[model samples]
Target: MKKTLIIAIVGILTFSCSKKEAEKNTEKTDSTNTVDSINTARTKINDSIKALNSKNRFRDFSGSHQFVYQNDSSPKYSGSINFTKIDGERDNYTLSGNIKSGKNSVTLKGFAQVVSAKHINFTGEITQSIVDNDNGKPYTRKGTKTFMSKDDGKTYRLQDMVNGSGFVDYIDIHF
Candidate 1:
């Protein structure tokens, strides 16, 4: 009877030890799986960010254009505009230029920020100046000629959102 009781106690101890070991192994496996999932998610997020930056790099807005002012059938004035790319979350250009006809000339300064794949907004507010085409009576021209434009890679087709029938004299900036 004593021998039988000892054998039974040994068997129970063995079974209990095996069960505890199995539980420990399962905990280790669960922890490893969680770590692997976190690493995979982090890698995916980094790849997505790199792809976004690469796509934006091609939409660079940096160049120079010699602009000739045309009033009626003749080129009344001449000037140059230079667009310099400013690197940041927003893709844009700082514009600095002028239009000159002999001794008389008008200067321009502003910035244009990309609003779409083919559109940008211009803000000519450096000087806070305005031009009246003819006399000071009609508020014809302001520091900002066009608020928006269509950008087709090479050139910008200026859009005067404030154009009207009475607006006979207009400023056209093609680049």
Candidate 2:
């Protein structure tokens, strides 16, 4: 009877240990899987960037667009602006453009960010110090822009305007 009791206690302890070991293994496997998924996502983003680089699609881009600024009391003002994409870094790009406003030409310097293959955001600080060619009034604007692409990375469509109390500027690009 003493031997039998000892055996039963040992059996219970062994069973409990086995279950704990199994639980530990399960947790380890889950952690590994999460790491693998993160790596896979990083690889996919890298592959897309490589594809864009192979095509030279992002190098030296130029386009023309019409910009309209919305105001509270009056109809919006519309004018044309041109953009030139300068190549330096993937995260940031330079832009040079002229925006027409009330017979004035506003010079623009823009820096753009590519958050991912599907998202593009840009912010530009404009010098309103330009002498108005017609009205002789100085103009200034400061704004940020966001654009999204449904495609992998081929084209970027404007999303919204934020951080500026000036105008609703629309840019039309051909690429």
Candidate 3:
């Protein structure tokens, strides 16, 4: 009877110790997975910044793009914008293009300064023509725009815009 009690106590101790060890191991694994996920996200962002910095910001920017206005209810404007001139040393460029959607058209001429791999500041004048029914009127506006990339520089978003009136937000840009 004494031997059996001793054996039972030993068995319980062994089982308890093994269970505690298993829990510890699971905690370690969970912690490691969290760290790994964080590292992966960091790597992706870093890769995007590197890719953006390596390319000619001016050349790559010459393409057809779609701009969705934050405050407008109309569909997005699609057009071709080109950087006609660039100063590589100063990271400045001039762009001119026209974009249209429905009866609204915009002619834009602008200069952009590359602030970093992920950001660009633009100052431009836009001649916007809107046709209400059969009548059309053109208006000119000057503004400053800030472009920022969030997803590893795969695309850029127009985060802020300052015109004569005030600041505009939530304008999305796709390249």
Candidate 4:
């Protein structure tokens, strides 16, 4: 009876030790995964910024367009916009500056984070009231632009424009 009890206790100890090691390994794996996710997000943000700063898009550009919100319920307001870069800045740099779309002028603030040379993410914020094209009155709403890019510093398209519109006009993104 004594020998049997001793053997049972040894077996339990061995099993418990093995279980603890397994749990530790799982924890290590989870930690590694979390780190990788964070790095990926940072890389995406950085790449987005670089793409918006491309000179090909902003090297003295002008265009007129209309925008509709969700549906055609809004009136179509037409407008022209111009874009130019600040003096002495790199071709592919962070974009946070002024823009003139139609009769309204506003400043743009942008955020970009990079995890590596390839992964990037970019976001832009516009906070100010501008004159409404339909009524010629001040319109108030915060605007944010977002996009993603894989290229080192090339073309970038619109990801999203959030919160704000007047007279159904397409946004002008120049410089």
Candidate 5:
């Protein structure tokens, strides 16, 4: 009877140890799978953010849009802005736009340097041609100003930074 009881206790201990080992291996596999999934998720999220930044940073300002000046809407000055990518760093761009209202017209040529996500420094010229010689004041070329996007990134608005802004409040380039 003593031998039988010893054998029974040893059998129970061996079965208990085997069961515990199996549970430990299962836990290890589960933890490894969880870690792998987390890493994959992180990589995908990083790729998405990079794509969005590239899209918003560089844009094609195509399609016709009205250039509103000093709340004037009698006859629309319609034009489109074009971007020629500069050869240097990614932040530099050659900006050009043209608009016309009857015989009067305007042309904008500038270098747009990105200052931040919300601002750009435009240093260039706006030349107004009055073919009919209208008596209205010319846009007197406020050559340098910071362009800000008023409607998110759809329209970039620039205004003269000084007083007596030549009857021009701002110009919206639907970039």
Candidate 6:
């Protein structure tokens, strides 16, 4: 009877230990799955952000733009501006263009920061050179311009401008 009782107690202890080990393994698997789920969520969110940044409004503004000075109704300096390159992402972009205005023309290289879909701020250097009687003399000008769009970016009204030559009070720009 003593030997039988000792065997029964040993059996119970062994069963209890095996059950505890199984529970521990289950807990470990649950923890690992939770970690993997969090990592997957993070990767998805990061990819979405990257995709949104890649498709910005600047991409739509690429091409040749013809602009007329609204304030000068006499058409003193009507010009066609051609964009050669536009680079960057989101609301910030770097642009290079050639602007021809009557007897004066310049190569404009600039950076634009979008305050909103309807507002933009620009800083650029204008380099000009004389090639013929119609062209202006060689000169360089640095300028900052702020523009606001009243028609949902279809047309921009120049609110203010400051440059090396002087400050232009306000003018309208349409593309």
Q: Provide the clashing-pair count of each candidate structure.
A: 0, 3, 0, 13, 0, 0
User: TM-scores of the models, in the given order?
Assistant: 0.49, 0.37, 0.47, 0.33, 0.52, 0.59
lDDT digits (tens) for residues 1-175 of candidate 1: 9999999999999999999999999999999999999999999999888667644433666787764344342345656777787754446679877766544444557887776666666777422112333331323234544433344544454555232223422234455
CA lDDT scores, all candidates in order:
0.58, 0.56, 0.65, 0.46, 0.65, 0.61
lDDT of 3 by residue, 31-136 (tens): 9999999999999999887766555644356444655443333355556566543533346768676777777776767987767778877799766554531244
Ranking by TM-score: 6, 5, 1, 3, 2, 4
lDDT value, residue 96 of candidate 5: 82
lDDT of 4 by residue, 1-175 (tens): 9999999999999999999999999999999999999999999998887765543432332222122122134333322222224433332234454445565554445543332343324445544334543343444333444433345424232344433552333333322
Q: Least accurate stretch of 10 residues (summed lDDT) in model 4?
A: 62-71
Compose the digit string of candidate 2's lDDT tens values, residues 33-129: 9999999999999988876654433444446655434324334444455555545345556655555655444455687666666665778865432
Alpha carbon deviation, residue 66, candidate 5 (Å): 7.1
RMSD of 4: 15.3
| lDDT of candidate 6 over 1-175, digit per residue (tens) | 9999999999999999999999999999999999999999999999898778666655366666754432211233445554333343666666555546565554656876777778877788656543342234565656877769989777766564332234242233455
Residue 64 in model 1: lDDT: 75
**What root-mean-square deviation over C-alphas does model 3 reach?**
16.4
Worst 10 residues of 3 by lDDT: 162-171
lDDT value, residue 117 of candidate 3: 74
State in Å the error of residue 112, model 4: 26
Better of 3 and 4 by lDDT: 3
Error of 2 at 72 (Å): 2.8
Model 4, residue 128: distance off in Å is 49
Model 5 gets an lDDT of: 0.65
Off by over 4 Å in 1: 1-58, 126-157, 161-175
Error of 5 at 39 (Å): 36
Between prediction 1 and prediction 2, the one with superior lDDT is 1
